[model samples]
Target: MSFTDSTEAPIYAGLVEEQGDVPAEVRRVAEEVLREADRAIDFGTVGAASAR
Candidate 1:
């Protein structure tokens, strides 16, 4: 998914690069955070949501 607001290339190459090879549970939570951040960003602010 498109996470960052920038038009520049993403800092990390991919999800694997961003979160590393963590456990399933950790990865799940990380993905949720990413989604929430993206959601909040879409609404305008990074703090728009609790988990954003």
Candidate 2:
């Protein structure tokens, strides 16, 4: 799922909006990280691990 559709998106949006001075690069990196995290959560491990 896209970052905007993730659960954290609203909170992140609120924080970012409150911090109006956030730099463009920082915003870009933060959004990228969020998107990656969202993707990971959406496509996480599908089964229990075998005994190690």
Candidate 3:
């Protein structure tokens, strides 16, 4: 999934920047995690109903 707004990139970038110099692989994984979190938040914010 992708971000719906441009504002998210900078916030995510700031999160990455705060980590200092992390290993390339670790950084990649962290970014993937952040993206997933952003997707989940967006889905929740838009009020998508859930069966559970």
After superposing candidate 2, which stretches have Cα over 4 Å from the reference? 1-22, 43-52
TM-scores of all predicted structures: 0.37, 0.37, 0.37
Please write out the lDDT profile of model 2 over residues 1-52, one tens digit for every residue.
6344337688656666677536766889999999999887854454434322
Error of 2 at 28 (Å): 0.2
Candidate 3 per-residue lDDT, tens place, 1-52, comes to 3232337676655655676435666879999999999977776645655643
The order of the candidates by lDDT, greatest first, is 2, 3, 1
* Candidate 3 stretches greater than 4 Å from native: 1-22, 43-52
Residue 45's lDDT in candidate 2: 52
Q: Model 1 Cα displacement at 46 (Å)?
A: 11
Residue 49 of model 2 has an lDDT of 41
Who is ahead in lDDT, 2 or 3?
2
Question: Model 1, 1-52: lDDT tens per residue?
Answer: 4444234435533554677535666879999999998877675543566675
State each model's CA lDDT, in order: 0.62, 0.66, 0.65
> How many collisions per candidate?
0, 0, 0
User: TM-score of predicted model 1?
Assistant: 0.37
